[model samples]
Target: MKIYDWFDGPYPARVRIALAEKGLLSRIEFVPVNLWTGEHKKPAFLAINYSGTLPVLELDDGTLIAECTAITQYLDVLDGNPLLTGRTPAEKGIIHMMTKRAEIEFLDAVSTYFHHATPGLGPDVELYQNREWGERMRDKAVRGMHYFNGVLANRPFVAGNEFSMADIAVLGGMIFASLVKLPVPDECEALRAWHARMLERSSVQEWRAMVERGQGVKTLPITADLK
Candidate 1:
């Protein structure tokens, strides 16, 4: 399997961490899609994934899977373990719900703020930006932090007792927030504590190490034969 993504990207980090958790990191090859160079938006890469997102999984038989949740779901079930997503119907439902909430209320909001309010991917990639809308999204992200803080105050994980895809989704939000210098409010003690514990996970540690190693490395050039 080959995963086309940019190292250190928050969305990619979610899938990378999931791969590490499933002990499948060694089984796959990582192809860097330079986010800074707008490689993902280019025609060559867009052919592989119409959405033009990073962390796309290309199976050995030429099957392509885009979107983090879908990729994680596929990888989670590959070993018949289904650890990250869920095993039971109830677990699946709750996990999926929380994960979607995490994306809408947090991660995606942070992304909008970065792309609009900040000079995200530079002027080349960001053709149109609405600073007003971005600022609103930024505020929404902060409110999301508070909301998650409330959720974490009562439970050990985002979805419930055990860490699931939902936790990873929130972690992606936290990662994006950090990248954009969006500080989690000091009052959100529960969220802060939860984030600290997440950082200690081996999968997250491994992802961090990979990010450190990826720093300053030149990205692969976009080409017609990316496959």
Candidate 2:
């Protein structure tokens, strides 16, 4: 399988973490898609995914899978007991619900803020932006952190006791949140604690090591304005 990904991007990082967790890191080829250069919007890349998204998975038979959650769903079930996406029907539903929430309330919100409120990928990529809308979505991401914190207060993970894709999605969102300097609410102790624990996971640690080795830069460089 060929995984088209951007090393520095959070969405691809989600799939990378999942692959690591599944112990399938060596099973696929990682193709770097340089988002900073506006390569993703080019015609060749668009042919792979019309949405011009990163971290796409191409199966051996030439089947392409787009979207982070969809790729997670496929990779999670590839082997073993399928712990990431859940094994049972009810578990699946809850996991999917939380995953979507993480995407909408957290990751997507931060992305909107980055692209709209800030210069984002610069004028080359972000053709349109709404500062007001971006600010509103940034607030939503903070609220998401609080909502997840409340949920974590009741359970160990986002979906349940087990570490599921929802947890990974939240972690990915947090990483993005950090990149944009959207600090997690200080009072969200439960969420902060959970994030700490997530950092200790082998998959996360491995990804960190890779980043240190120059496989990717986990977060974008902070400019003077952000600081």
- Once superposed on the true structure, which residue ranges of model 1 sit more than 4 Å away at CA? 215-222
Give one digit per residue, the lDDT tens place, for model 1 in 87-125: 899999999999999999999999999999999999999
Query: TM-score for model 1?
Result: 0.96
Model 2 C-alpha RMSD vs. true structure (Å) is 6.4
- Among all windows of 10 consecutive residues in model 2, the one with the lowest summed lDDT is 218-227
Q: Candidate 2 on 119-196: residue-level lDDT in tens?
A: 898899998999999999999999999999999999999999899999999988998898899998889999999999
**What C-alpha lDDT do the candidate models reach, one value each?**
0.92, 0.86
Please name the candidate that would achieve the greatest TM-score relative to the true structure.
Answer: 1
| Candidate 2 wrong stretches, greater than 4 Å | 216-227
Q: Where does candidate 1 have its weakest 10-residue lDDT segment?
A: 215-224
